[model samples]
Target chain A: MSETPTPDGSPSTWSEDRLHRWLAEQSWPATLAGSRGHDAAVLETFAGRPVLCTDQCIEGVHFELGAGGRAAGRKAVLRTLSDLAATAAVPFAVTLGVMAPRSIEGVPLEAWLRAAITGAHDAATEHGAELVAGDLAMVEGPIALAVTALGHTSSGTVPVGRDRAQPGQLVLLSGPVGGSLPSDRHLEPLPRIEAGVAIAAAGATAMMDVSDGLAWDLYRLARASGVTVRLETERIQPHPDAEDAAASSGRTPLDHGLHDGEDHELIATIAAEDWAAFRREGAASGWHVIGTVEAMDRSAGHLQLRSPEGHSAWLPGAGRGWDYGGGE
Target chain B: MSETPTPDGSPSTWSEDRLHRWLAEQSWPATLAGSRGHDAAVLETFAGRPVLCTDQCIEGVHFELGAGGRAAGRKAVLRTLSDLAATAAVPFAVTLGVMAPRSIEGVPLEAWLRAAITGAHDAATEHGAELVAGDLAMVEGPIALAVTALGHTSSGTVPVGRDRAQPGQLVLLSGPVGGSLPSDRHLEPLPRIEAGVAIAAAGATAMMDVSDGLAWDLYRLARASGVTVRLETERIQPHPDAEDAAASSGRTPLDHGLHDGEDHELIATIAAEDWAAFRREGAASGWHVIGTVEAMDRSAGHLQLRSPEGHSAWLPGAGRGWDYGGGE
Candidate 1:
């Protein structure tokens, strides 16, 4: 999140009513948020075929509020945009549902809220999406956010999906993964939207975002596509943060790349024939050819790691990078 | 929300993993919420002018969990749909961001979550909107929800906005308001989409929802439109629920009608000449002509209560029926 100026007039007193009035006086997305008269936000005109996605980020569940509201809002929006990237949808607009606690890190609510809303607004603005929504709840619980992103699929390109991978297809990773949590890198997920659009344009068959560790997410894609994905272990490389943390964690950097979650990398699949043309456009440069899709053994798991030493079918949850269901 | 049967196989061994697996096996909006394959929900095609709105419902803040998950879910979706109704937009889709605490009302997390999902699904289906989105957070905090409702404006009818009211226009209320909290009538807000559409077709100048009590919301509309709304006290009628609660409470039924919150009714304005044509279509029935729009004093509040005895300008927060920002 950008370190902009502190909110003007942090409010004489910290009250939800005053916070709302303060929000209205500011120059954010007044059409939807902070305005009392607008019952619901209306986009006067948008005639494209749209795709919608929503995601949640809760303090104490997804991340701590130590970094404050700007980071919180940024992460929430980036995650939603990440989902849109996974779908290869062109980002258009973003909306938020915020449930905020009375205070943030002992600071009054208004300052933090202003920063958070600015964070979301700036992020959406940077990515060509408008931040709009009129929902704000003053809760006594942890700060929770629900971000909904809406977009359109690029013309002539079908939305890349998760269950269309076919046997003999190659799997691609948008970038390196690992150590996002330990290094606090997860807070800055780059939306791989351009990569996704290119992949779809290249006639990619399927795609998924690597929010959960590559191992578990790949397994999900394989199972969904009814195919087995065999990872080329030697080809997988650890991100710089992964290597930086590997020294003290007593684990290999590659281990983190395979199991660490929240990297927000794009995972796409395409026929071997398309691989050459997919890279012809330099925009697809960072993507790594990591694995190949194969026929799945109906009775076994649909994921495998093929190292020089050997290969074996991997089971779900055996090495899950992150399981939100497994309470904090 | 419809009271469907309890979720299947409440997962013998309760765990987030099991909950997820069981959820995937169900027949909800698998394309979004309950599925693992789709990275994001996609409407393959949607070609209309879109209007988007989002709202939040946090347990202990918005409603209590005593009624269980179904009621909670129903109220959340209904609130969102009500916002769309206020905007004069047709409902198309709904998405959720849920932050659930474990063991709602002594029930296991899975059962409550299942019922909650079904509640949202059924409510959206009943309103001609599809419920889709893949975002759920399990927190130890209150069950907080963020619902985003999307739809399009009907062709030929301009979206009834908040800043178009003119002096000498008539202010209309879609239905009765007040005592929603005490009567538990807030749990079932009827979407006034058809009424709003009809009102807009009748060339309504401004619109807002009565989520924040009639006095406050009308003042907001007046401020936005730079006009004053002079309400005729005799013309306003308290809802049956409001009267029922007024018998026990010291306040008058008219007071409750003017101040009570959570009655998701539509407040619209139209030129006095348009009233005849507005009612020409039967769909506009049930709308009450409660007030008239006049030039604002600029110094005083933009709302007034006029009765047989006297007329006085109403302050914004004076005798507020409800203040969400004021915590319980």
Candidate 2:
């Protein structure tokens, strides 16, 4: 904010001019060049139906304060992209809003800010989206980052919704889940963008991202669809991190798999006939059949967890990686 | 976020179901219904070149933490819309990211949050746009809000930019400016969306909204266009609020008119011949021909303030609507 720089080149002294200069040097997408030098970015019409989603991360809320800038930024961008993945949409563009603190664990604020932006920008670019607009401000508080991703379903393909699951449908997960937060795996989530599109293309009827734990998110999906999700506990795959975390947590790895947040994995429900086609085509290769959809009257709650020994329990509404009451 | 309601039915305890129910009842645009009931909002292809812009407001940074909730929301939405106005883009949709503080001036956090969202939602709707997507979070610090607006230039109209002013072009201001912050006028800025379109349609070469003071914005336009703006100091329109403040501030109203922030007025540069057409068509009504654009080498600075007697001085970079020693 000042022209005078500190001897160590602290970022607190990064002027607006320096900020602009840094911005001008980013590897902006070629298609966006025409939109440069303006108050807004101009782009052509989006393909198919335009999808819009916004996600924000706050220090101490979503992540710890000063917990690595690049990690924070990646989490923000990837989580936003995960929302689009829930709908099987193609990434088109993104916009970011940053409210940063003056100091962060003694790291130059500029360096943190730049690393955060680079992380966000790189993640977006890698996922086929371009950063088109951004707004930055330095405030007297914890760092907060917000990202909006504008995307679209492929032509002729309508976006999938959580409310479309049928009672006779099968539920699947793109990969293993759990122990994301304790393992610091939430920081650099691997969004299942392509897998989501493939699953949708394979005729999945309903889908969502497991960002707020499998138990809670499945509850949401089942409630939306007016059906129950009977998660087959024995069939579910818990990540190695979940197993590692279970050692000291006094809970099984399956508990972590069922309740950990920020997995960024896709959970889709499709009819048996559709699943057969999807499997034959190898689209469901690494994906697991973790559950089945059922009528609400057949379960105690919207989401029912069933064990291999014929044991069953209704999970709680809010879930953490550790046990929260519903266990076999 | 509890299901149990207080004796007085406080909003702070409003549950997630209540939030969703509140959202479902909003007067969402008919066009966006396809995007509803999902993690994201979707819409058909935008009308022309798509315009993307983001803006944010933070409590204690942009305004007082307890400032009227509705006013704060309006300011955020209106300011973001102003960027679209600068590019002559028609409003299409908006997505909001809210990081809310628990208690605000004793108003139930829910009430404040609702009022804020209502303010933003209403503003966007009134301007031919829709609030299509939104994300909300409860945080520990100051309430920080972010809004991303997606818009489009009218069909066949390329978005106007800051870097197109040419020599012999006439500079114009949409209306009176200054004293916005002191007068609380910044809280409800009337974006020049329609006028910006008219100017761009009238063949104006360059345009921008006078947000960060006419002086600084003009300097930006000049620098971007690689031209110098010659201001005719007497021709500017000082708002009555500026005049009212000047009486007690001991500075001329024009000083405030020249340097006040958040004016949200449109500034346009047109060739004299084109200006004639704009005037003949009644498009120049209530607009002032404030200056002339000249080659950069023709002036001492990117923006040159010229008096009736030909006395002038180069203005400072960051303007505060106060004297910074550039007075002639």
- lDDT string for model 2 (A1-328, tens) is 2333345776443333455557766767557633465788888676687788999988886787557778888889989999998888988889988887555555666767778888888889889988888888766677889999998888777568888888989999989888888898888888788888888888888889998788878877887888888988988899999999999899999989888887888899988998898889876756778889988855467877888677455555344522211121
**Residue runs of model 1 more than 4 Å from their true location after superposition:** A1-14, A30-37, A281-283, A298-300, B1-19, B28-37, B298-300
Candidate 2 per-residue lDDT, tens place, B1-328, comes to 2333334576443233456557767767567634366787868775677788999888775666567668788888998999999888888899888876544444566666777888888899889888888887766678878999998888877557788899899998999988888888888889889998888888777888887789878887887888889999999899999998788888789989998888899998988887898899886766779999998865467888888778464555444522211221
Interface RMSD of 1: 5.8
lDDT (10s digit) by residue, model 1, range B1-328: 1222335534322245555565567665644421343767777455446788898887876678776778888888988988888877888888877777644444555677667777887888888887777467777778777889988877766666777788989999988878898888887778888887788878887888898898888887887788888999899878988898899998899889988888889999998778877676556677879999988775545888889999888876555734566521
**What is the DockQ score of candidate 2, to 2 decimals?**
0.46
Superpose all Cα atoms of candidate 1 onto the true structure and report the RMSD in Å to 1 decimal.
4.6
TM-score of chain A of each: 0.90, 0.91
Q: Candidate 2: which pairs clash? A: none
Return the clash pairs for model 1, or none. none
**Model 2: docking quality category:** acceptable
Per-residue C-alpha lDDT of model 1 across residues A1-328, encoded as one tens digit per residue: 1222335534322355555566557665644421343767777454435778898887876677778789888888998898888888878888887777655544556667777877887888888888877577777677777899988777666666788888999999988888888898888788888888788788788899998899988987887788989898888878999998898899999899999888899998998878877677665767879999988866546888888988877776566545666521
User: What DockQ do the predictions score, one after another?
Assistant: 0.49, 0.46
Candidate 1 A-chain TM?
Answer: 0.90
Q: Each predicted model: what fraction of the native A–B Cα contacts (within 8 Å) does it retain?
A: 0.64, 0.53
